[model samples]
Target chain A: MLAAERRDHLLELLARQGKVVAKDVAADLGISEDSVRRDLRDLAAEGLCQRVYGGALPVSPAVADYAARQTVTPDGKRKVASVAAGLVRPGGAVILDGGTTALAVAHALPKELSCTVITHSPTIAAALLDHPRAELFLLGGRVFKHSAVTCGAAAVEAAQNVSADLCLLGVTGVHPEVGLTTGDAEEAAMKRALSARAADTYILASSEKLGTASRFRVLPWEKVSGVITDADAHHPVVEQVKALGVEVLTAS
Target chain B: MLAAERRDHLLELLARQGKVVAKDVAADLGISEDSVRRDLRDLAAEGLCQRVYGGALPVSPAVADYAARQTVTPDGKRKVASVAAGLVRPGGAVILDGGTTALAVAHALPKELSCTVITHSPTIAAALLDHPRAELFLLGGRVFKHSAVTCGAAAVEAAQNVSADLCLLGVTGVHPEVGLTTGDAEEAAMKRALSARAADTYILASSEKLGTASRFRVLPWEKVSGVITDADAHHPVVEQVKALGVEVLTAS
Candidate 1:
């Protein structure tokens, strides 16, 4: 096969399986592993995919620049955010994650709802300014500009000071096997720290994030209490998640 | 004089003197003390001025809504912010307060300069998103919607975590006699806490705030390192502040 054709085929496999193993792809195409690795490296260099140890994973489309990500599954983000916002019981403390989806969740929260919101995102904190009754806490740390969120030792240590009833965790990708993931390692660590401070954590997955894998893993299936998503209800991956004994909360 | 005339005259005196003593106003106008008190009450009810123990003080225009205050003293805020921004030595840590002037300071900061910024204001933190090299820390606390900053006991506790090289404090009022003040008691406490965390704290005083007096006292004159202002050079308040052994940094 031509190199361009093989690269297209690799992308198709990644979309379908959420990852491409070099050994499997080489055998399936009757090509050498070296050729497959070279293709993967080229793709990674172009920012099309994340090159892994033995293969490649898709880079998260959700981590695009703020303006660019606004067009990435916006309606689906709103639907998923609506469901995530509903999880907040009045008067409860919630740990909110930072991302476009989480920003959507901030917009989706009721104006009169009097819950305490704790987050490390300045953007989220600024969005909640006009919220009449909701009390917000912005955790301090070194900022991660791409996500407009705070991470690092300071943020993690600050997270330990609060006990939250629920955490709405936003990640770039959610796969049945690879679990929840994002594009940055420090952000993944911060999310883990936030989850530990909460009694229950729920995944906020819009349609595009499903069946995709990013560079860093966040939580395993057992770590999250539920998944709030707007993905197709009948999708097999949704069924696969359900089969793992996890509650799947679907948005309309 | 007519009641309308008397009230207007009272406003003028308050503007010139930063406060109105009922006894003095009554004596000056040849009116009953009761009549003067009634007029001051009417003015306070209209939000025209803040009624103090024995008279009234001019209300802070800085405490108005963000949009309304945008048109108020913009040039002064920018000039004050320019001088305030210059105080941030490259590679040093700065504690930034809330309000439009501080937002201006965030804007005035050179994007190429690298520094660590700690703040309790989401608006200031949001403004710094485009700053390429400044590291920001947003202290977690209950959101103060009026000023788009954070305060309360949680915020005061959060202030103790870090030490900064300088603090640029924003307040509604800065009077030599009243010391430093703001509209809300909790916000005043938060500012005091922030001042303690920094080695040198400079007051961000636009022209409007130079001789004003708000309800809550923030800090005494002895506590602050200097005052940055765009108030007239020969303005008695500026001269008075300078005479108190406080460094008066003027922004052209």
Candidate 2:
């Protein structure tokens, strides 16, 4: 693993265990104990963890902070988020699906925009808490601990009642014929309900997400109104999606 | 256990297991198989569970609804809820701590009153999902599944940044000297932050909480502005709290 990915995994493990031992980190990540200690020291400097006798413990419950998420896909997601946010207008009610990309759209939303954002993702709801003018409708259902989102029938039913202005989706896998898909079956059901409620739809993705397929299908390419991605979104791939009458927003 | 408690526990087991045999329920709850079958039949009649071949199972996910929480402290919480909701003004920003009493207050809120509500409880956030005019902010933190609330540094920091007009607190335990207390240390830290950031703080607690103390201390009694509770809060024990200069609101 790259040093960055190792640090991210270390942080995730510490979050789950509430502390981490240098020995365990070394064994788990196959890094040297000295290197593990160095990583812990680096994280401790940022106040993300506190180095102790042998392992590191969280300095604050703030370990759940989205600072880690912010470090990911900064530019690409910002552009995609801008495109998705533009689709929303004041007084509009919309559904936001869970994923780093959907969270990106939420992160870039103008604080002055007033709208109702319904979402299953706890992280997305957290992202919107500081949005002074936005109204948030968080769906309730069985909590999926790993993804920090809600799923199951309750989430689907709650989403069904929202005849929304738009649905800003985070597509995990997309194919011309297969449409959009994800690895989680329950989230697929939630995405379909969210998609069905909206009058218009947009999928925020990174270039790498294109041409990849996960196990569960969410929607077909024909169901999406547009695709917003980064500048290097693969020329031929963008052309193929555009051929289907779907608008494409490419950020430079 | 009484037949009612047996039925509830049986339903809880079925909800978790997806199915339950009368023999297993009998062994688990230490009851006769005949009584277990009777309890299952009773729950089936209530539309809470379905009788399967040789067992019972949850009819729907809704069987695990908030109604289960209501059976916990029905009268005392309802009495406290009346006074608590009265403290909230229309068009105000209110902070709700995660507790049965605070949840009760959310349920008792006037349907048409418009306000901004900040909460750490998924249950409270879910309750407000269909409230057309209520603006909701759900704190993001490590979710504590048992309590259905988020806690840790993120939730605490989010509460700190919000200058709410009022904060409604729930007490697991209370003492005239020790103030409000809770069972969880992280939740207490969050409650302290929520209390510190609010202009007015009200502890809406049942009379049963008056003399008890929990492991985590939230605050000293003097910091609280008011205590809203049942009229029977007239016990001299509670009068000692009134003597500390905090106004007390009683539900008639």
Candidate 3:
């Protein structure tokens, strides 16, 4: 296919699948992986898609601010949240990452299921109050106003002391090659610190985040135990994630 | 199963039954009695449960934290908060204490109002997100989960740096003779420290707190600038507070 035709095809795939892996696109379209990367970079430059390590995602304004993100794909987020909440074993310790999706997980948690919830987001901590059986530990640090979560040296240090069974990570982007990503550098560091302290880490992202890339990388694909999204199990992104040896869970 | 998983199972039992004996946990988990005791000891140390002579008991039945407290006398809290929010000048800095009442004030803030808000509660900070023009500074410390606010030495140190135009203080008890008080000693100290940093401090309480006394004294009645409550301004408690030379503002 011509280069223009290839780029158009890639955008179509991204629009339909919510993500496009460079390697997968190359094999399907008989193009070089380098050509896929070039097209993705061009698209990112044009503000059409965001380029990640090995894939590109549809451009999302949600990364610009927390308020805008909350309004985007609300139903998808609720679905993703419900599935993620199911992963929590009763009475286990869960480290909740900050974001709208994680907040949704906190809301979806069963009121009678006793668990210890540790989070740096005051919002998530507050949501857990309705869960009468949940014990909450709020990590303290400099509050990042944009995200409404604490992030600083103190927050990172505090996260290190918590050894949780599971970490429900919220990310702005999830790419097969770029892994998990967010907007701020310090916040990304804090998230990495949090994930390091947990035995099992799952990234909670709606379909909108699939194949998207943000400014700061949080975890590599290998580090994540699973990716829970609102997409179907047979979706292309899910297939790509599974091919990477990571479990994929769909809310639908 | 991992030791941590086993411990989680024991906690689940404690949540459902309120208490668990070592022998019972051992038999249920197919583990030894000694293992159960060790788990109970570890849990107790973490403050997840209370260790008794036998096994363990769920942490104190009293839910005095911010979330639990939010449901108690909510109408009264809304009255108090509405009055407190009205007290804020259009562009002045306000120091907010951590509690259900203070959180209500955050929510009651007018969207068009512009101001700076300094707070130790993550929940309060999150609430202020709706106020687009408000600038928020969150204090750092060990999060006192019960109140959904930061406390301890670090939180106090952080509070010292902020000089606000007004402080909205939340307390568990506001007595005519005993003054302002709360449940935890460190939390009281943090509240006192926050009050000292603000130019003027107002205590937000409902009728239930008017004549009650808590464990830790946060301030003397003489130090508070005003007492804001849901009771009538002519009520006895209002008169008592006014006699102490503190201004009293009632919602109705």
Task: Kindly list the per-residue Cα lDDT of model 1 for residues A1-252, writing each as its tens digit.
Answer: 235446656775676457889998875555689999999999999999999899998797433233343445378898998889999999999999998899989888997999999999989999888688998887877778778888999889889888899999999998999999999999999999999999999999887888999999999999999999898878888999999988899998
Candidate 2 stretches greater than 4 Å from native: A1-252, B1-73, B231-233
Which runs of model 1 end up more than 4 angstroms from their true locations?
Answer: A1-73, B1-73
Q: Give the per-prediction TM-score of chain B.
A: 0.71, 0.71, 0.71
- Which candidate number maximizes DockQ? 1
Query: Which pairs of residues clash in candidate 1, taking residues 3 or more apart in a chain or in different chains?
Result: none
lDDT of 1 by residue, B162-230 (tens): 889999999989897888999999999999999999999999998778789999999999999999998
lDDT of 1: 0.85
Of candidate 3 chain A, the 10-residue stretch with the lowest lDDT total is A64-73
lDDT of each: 0.85, 0.74, 0.81
Give the i-RMS of model 2 in Å.
17.7
Model 3: lDDT of residue B150? 78
TM-scores across all candidates? 0.70, 0.44, 0.61
> lDDT, candidate 1, residue A228?
91
